[model samples]
Target: MDSLDLEVLTRARAWLDDGHRVMLATVVRTWGSSPRPPGALLALRDDGRAVGSVSGGCIEDDLIYRLQRDGMPESPQHVSYGVGAEDARRFGLPCGGTMELVLEPLRDAAPLDALLARLAAGELVERRLDIASGRSTLAAAHPEQGTAFDGETLTSVFGPRYRLLLIGAGQLSASLARIAQGLDFAVTICDPREEYREEWNIPGTTLTREMPDDVVTAMRPDARMAVVALTHDPKLDDLALMEALRSPAFYVAALGSRRNNAARRERLREFDLNAEQVAALRGPAGLYIGSRTPGEIAVSIAAELVAVKNGVAAERVLKVATAKAALDIAADTLSACATR
Candidate 1:
């Protein structure tokens, strides 16, 4: 269950290695209610076979219909969909949504291979979309690199982002890690306790006996990645959170009760975290579910994690996912995806 972007890139690399011409399309910008967001990617083969998506069926059908027979233009071209009055009517644009795409046929070998290699290593590299000159450059914060693109005029679009992380090895950790794995997170479960560590059997998760703090410090989580402490142990949860707040991990939370979570935060104030960092603690952990069991708690927590990761405010998402039975579906869905 790799991300749609990863799957597209993987297939693109295979095609490139096969010595087949590949046309790449990325949604540079979107407005209103487009089917795909700004970074949506679609690869056009020399023939007609295509994987990945730019739209829900209709837009892809339109794209395939327009470019499949032309067999990918030799020069890079920029195109838009659901724009203006007539095109919007014709395409059935939802609420007047518009999207622009960049179409570049496989021409240069240097950049494509470099990007593929970085992606294979699971690095979050930024590809700057220069609409004016129809050129893009890949930028990564590396030891040998400190570069920026300022010459862009029309618009710039970011490339595919990275995944999420989970710390702790209990059932809730297992369940959340499993679901996050499908969401294209390179999830890892860090639990030093033997009772919990022995039950670590989730697929696509790298389980470690090393303490959570050391492991997180070693990996260095980023804004694209998130950390959720499922252990509820102050020793494990607090130490890992100390490191998580200092890093760029976009989301950080722990499973705990109101009193327990309050205590956890009060203790961390001694570690010199600011009010902002301390305020980031999410608990009554997860959306309030009245969950009396482990699995239900996992769903409530995971749903909150998803909302936070997606940049949706907790208030907006909790309403939809508050049902006890909904948690079961989420837990089961996560189980199915990771196990398979």
Candidate 2:
């Protein structure tokens, strides 16, 4: 689940505690070109206040209007939008897109509180809701399982869907952690240096004083995981990369300039890693965003990470290395012309 949906649940629980009637909406399915995917959440209050989104804007507006005019349903109900071309245009759905949503009125906050607690404990939870009874059940969920609905019950996966391990606890890592958290990534910061570890202070991230290699080994990074080495020290970064590259981690990156990255790749080749493993290393890890500060660099790295996670083609993304090389060539050309 993304942070936006998590916020919906958090705000819904708070609203229920404050004696406000709240209805939770989840996109169960989409036909074509839908703005929100299946399992997207929207929490609507009795007064038409909402926390999340279900569509671009018009569908949400229609939902709010319905709440104001008709009132909340007594039980869970499934609602759909964009059934035809006219309705699609009216609801701002593109290409006649259609989406089905399951809306459940909240009578109590216990289930939500329980689900949130499990998520806080770093567990993936599957929540099943019976449409007729309006009761819900929670269980452990496999990483592969996603939101599913069959006419009667709706099962949705809730919690952080991706994990990020940053092999440094410095300013760059701190900024990246904040951005990753907002993107609903479970972030872990590993640093063996007591000097750096003691100064680390970031909430919603796991901080460890263990060696970077040990942390990576223990994590056993899978396809849904990413490993980034922000520490400039080869002693700390190289070992982690050696282990991460050999694993199934979708992204294994290090922070450095082009020359430094080239040297780092050479150093990794001396280890047990093969040429293929060393080639997987994404050095100067970020898009070509011309970022200079730690915050801007964090944004650039996060953007690249998201693009990779979504399976965007490498040729489609402008990488920092490729862009910087072009810029260097252009600068040399300009300097030569000036001298002439």
Using lDDT, give the best candidate's number.
2
Task: Locate the minimum summed-lDDT window of 10 residues in model 2.
Answer: 88-97
TM-score for each candidate, following the candidate numbering = 0.71, 0.97
Among residues 3 or more apart in sequence or in different chains, the pairs in candidate 1 whose N, CA or C atoms overlap within 3 Å are none
Question: Which pairs clash in model 2?
Answer: none
Please give the lDDT score at residue 228 for candidate 2. Answer: 97
lDDT of 1 by residue, 105-164 (tens): 765556667776776665656666554555667766432222232334223222334445
**What's the true lDDT of residue 64 in model 1?**
77
> Which RMSD does model 1 reach against the true structure?
8.7
lDDT of 2 at 195: 89
